[model samples]
Target chain A: MKFVIQRNQLIASVQDVMKAISNRTAIPILTGMKIEVKNHGITLTGSNSDISIESYIPAEEDGIVNVEQIEEGSIVLQAKYFPDIVRKLPEQTVEFEVDENLKVTIRSGKAEFNLNGQDAEEYPHLPKLQTDDSFEMPIDILKSLIKQTVFAVSTMETRPILTGVNVKLNQDKLSFTATDSHRLASREITVKADGINDLNVVIPGKSLNELNKILDDTEETVEISVTNNQILFRTKHLIFLSRILDGNYPETSRLIPEQSKTTIHVNTKELLNTIDRASLLAKEEHNNVVRLTTLENNIVEISSNSPEVGKVTEEITVQSFEGEELKISFSSKYMLDALKAMEVDEVNIDFTGAMRPFIIRPENDDSILQLILPVRTY
Target chain B: MKFVIQRNQLIASVQDVMKAISNRTAIPILTGMKIEVKNHGITLTGSNSDISIESYIPAEEDGIVNVEQIEEGSIVLQAKYFPDIVRKLPEQTVEFEVDENLKVTIRSGKAEFNLNGQDAEEYPHLPKLQTDDSFEMPIDILKSLIKQTVFAVSTMETRPILTGVNVKLNQDKLSFTATDSHRLASREITVKADGINDLNVVIPGKSLNELNKILDDTEETVEISVTNNQILFRTKHLIFLSRILDGNYPETSRLIPEQSKTTIHVNTKELLNTIDRASLLAKEEHNNVVRLTTLENNIVEISSNSPEVGKVTEEITVQSFEGEELKISFSSKYMLDALKAMEVDEVNIDFTGAMRPFIIRPENDDSILQLILPVRTY
Candidate 1:
């Protein structure tokens, strides 16, 4: 295989595919990136046991030539040093030539590198995902959906299914929910869809994070196809495939409280800062718990005390307060994560009781909700 | 003790003293920062076994008030979290008040932090260095002198003295030299002095690095005092004291060749870039060796070949070449370090022969010199 391509274009494609490559893969060939040259363009593929990523660079896009003198062939090169070499190449354009024995030669300016390439045929073939249960959503919306719920997924392997975010689609509405038993995050949005409904799939949170990182912030559409055990996300120049977790996601709707004994509306930034300061001393304690108490005159007091490291207390004025006065203690880290995901000036917090899970959401918005279980402080 | 200080001033002073604090110090009190509130100002001190740093925040400097409500007392606070707490305080001015029992209360805006403080009596007292051997030099020049030679210090602990930079003063001239036995770097400058002649001392490279980090990049003069076993560097708001290495420094003057068979003047930047690119493949090999061959017509060829990873060659045009033709190989990293330390547009390279040690210096300057030993390539 022989091809000459623009350095920037190649670097972009390599980075996209590198998201799926991990250093500790059991399959040796999986650590290499498969590069295939065709008449139309070049495709770079990287895969681990859980996910596969393919990024394509067309011969010419928008009247700008990205590749020239292309010959059709394929080889897998070690992904470890390929990205660094391409980034540090001297010239704007780099030429890659592979002989019959898979000896790859890369030349740019006056510098030349010959890297040993493995036969592409040894790479595992990605499963062909074919299903009518597919939907399309804007890349920015998908990225937001992943960010809002992925952090709540359980990082422990005791319950493997909890490590995946439950993605469910019914007719025109799509919902994502993740819970680590301590905290839960859920987001829902109306999306344009096609042939199927009542579809449920649990995608590993790690895979979703990698996918979100590669997705651009543009409003372009990303076509998502779901099969029995595999899901594929296809964009114009990139394709991502992930294997679904092999167990039913536990029902989490019952965890969120429907009624509240106390409700308060507060500026998100102000509350976030108060909790951040209160957590300083709390972090020294084992549970990292900070307590919030509603006082008279619509004021909320946040405090944390460590026996060995002193204490911290912060008072913030709330926008409004209603119902019975209440106090709750929860993980400061969980509260911060929930607050950061809500992109709003004001947030409405609902407390059921002192020892129950409470829900927080953007004021007057029902699309996204975060629930945290309060820790009992003796 | 009680004082209200500007947040920025407190942050700056804390950062300056933090250079001397390390978590792995054997002395438990060294892990804490000693804060003394005096009639004139507040002083913060951090010390490890090798070095001690004290930074003072005056009550008023240059007609600006940095502290108010000062009460004379002292306490030691844990250095691990002090910097973070001060940086994240809510208000522009932070109030620090210590109770009779050493309970420290820090208040800013509506946020209040109470930290447990240890009695300052347990903190080690800094030694008083009253010496007639003293010198004054621009802080910028001192920083430059440290940077020019510190990189050559041996990181291996086989020879402890080689891990320190030998600093000497003769008459009014100050010189600094460092070497790893394989390569050497030296720099010198003349400075105003008093009662210091033929004084030689070895300062640990790690201490110099920490001291260099805290020094401001201004032309303001800094007072330096040297005794038999201790050295003190004092600026307006900071005092840094470091213990000298207790061993004889081997003579490195004979390493630099007095004669040259071939001399070439080239742009420092071009040669650096060429060697950087050539080292890409060489890095994959163990030695990281790159060879430089002077061709006919004032052109230098830089190349490196790895048995398993092909080869790379780059040709760079030089300003001039004299004497005889020569080819030499050396560690690319060492060459890059020597080139970067020389803040000059052009550098003159002196080569004795293929196997002998070579010298590099700024085209017409004698203030700094670097000697690098060539590697034997079969």
Candidate 2:
């Protein structure tokens, strides 16, 4: 294979695929990126056993990519040294030529590098998914959906299913849920779909993180297709695929409390700042517990204590409150996480009891919610 | 002790002195900063047994400070938590009060903190140094002197003296030298200290690094005083004192070659880039050695080779040359450092032989010079 491409265009695409290149050498072939040239464009794909990313550069575009010579062939080049060489090249265009035995030569300006290459035939093929159960969503909306709930997913290896985000698409509404038993985050949004197809696939949280890093903040649409064991996300010239976890996800719909004996509305910024100050003293504790008490006038007391580090207390004039004069203790870190996920000025927190689980959500929004179990503190 | 100070004023002083407070608990008293209130001002000091810093906040400083209650007393407070607490306080002015038992209460807004404090009598006082031998220089010049040559100091523990930078201030010029036996970097600058006493001292490189972090990018004057065992740097409200190494520094004057048979002048930036590119291929080699050879018409050829990782060659045009054609191999990292230290458009390299030591300095200036020993490569 032989091709000459613009430096910036090749660099942008190479960076996107480099994220999926395997850093481990358990399988030596997995460390190389497979390169293929066709009459239309050039494609670069990197894969491990669990995830794969493929990006394409068209031969003729809006003056971004200029292809001088294109020979239809394929080769696998070492991903480690190839990207560094391209990034540091002193010229605006890079020339690539591969010999019959797969010894690739890269030339730019006055510098030339000859890298040992592997046979592209030895690389594994990516599974092709049928488009019968595909859906289209705006990239911005999809990015927010992943960011809002992905952090709460269980990172431990005990329950393999909880390590993935559960996506449930029914009719025109789509829902995403992630939980680690201690806390849970859920979000629901509307998307456009062709036929009535329900997808209840569990995607690995780690793979979603990689996908998030590669997805830029653009208004374009991203088409998603799922097969039996793999799911693919295709953009303009990028394709991201990940293996699905084969297990049953827990029913999180019942985990959120339906009733509350106490409700309080406080400024999100004020509560975040008060919690941050209290955390300094509470951080030494194993659970980082902080207590909150609502008074008659619209004032709430936030306090934390440590046996060796003293205690901290501050009063925040809340917006509104109802029900009994309530006092409860919970993990400061968990409360901080729930507060950060909120996007409005004011947030309402619901309390069922002193020892029961509670829910936190934006005061005006009902599509997103966060739940945390209160720690027993006397 | 009771006083009220502006938040910004207190924060600035606290940050400067906090540099000497080490996190290790091996010395318990060293973990706290000593606070002393006098009729003139309040002084705060922090030390780590090796270095001590004292910053003074005057009673009336251009209407920035307002001392409400003046009680002449002293105390020691924990350094780790005081800075964080002061930074997060909700008020513009912070009130500090101490009880008979040395218990300190810091009040800001409606929040209050009671911290355990120690009597200042137990804190070790810094050695009093008379200003018999002092010199004044521009802070910018002093900072530049430290930054240009400090990175070459040896980090090994076997030879503790090499871990410090040797400073020699003569009648008209001040010279700084640092090395780890493999390579040396030296820089000199002429000053206006005509009648100043000649002095020589070795200061720890780590202390200079901390000092650099606190120095502002202004043309303020910095008064430097060298005592028998301590060296103090006083600038405005900050006083930084560091313990000097108690050994003779090695004489590096003879290491610089006085004569050269081969001299090549090239653009500093061009040479730096070529060395960086060639080093990429030589990274896996034992010493990361890159070879430079003089070609016809004064063109310099830079190349590197690795049997298993291929080779790279780059050609950079020379501005001028008055030497025999020679090929020399040296550590790419050392060459890069020498080139970086010379702040000039073009540099002249004096090479005696392929295996002898070489000198690199600005083509127009003779104040600063960098020397590197060539490595034998077969």
Clashing pairs in 1: none
Error of 2 at A170 (Å): 1.3
What is the TM-score of each candidate's chain B when compared with the real chain B? 0.98, 0.93
Off by over 4 Å in 1: none
Docking class of 1: medium
Per-candidate DockQ vs. reference: 0.70, 0.54
Q: Per-residue lDDT tens digits of candidate 2, residues A284-371?
A: 6546888888866899998877655567788889889888888899888888888887777888899998888899898767789999
Q: Pick by TM-score: which candidate is best? A: 1
Backbone Cα, N, C clashes tallied per candidate: 0, 0
- In the order shown, the chain A TM-scores of the predictions are 0.98, 0.96
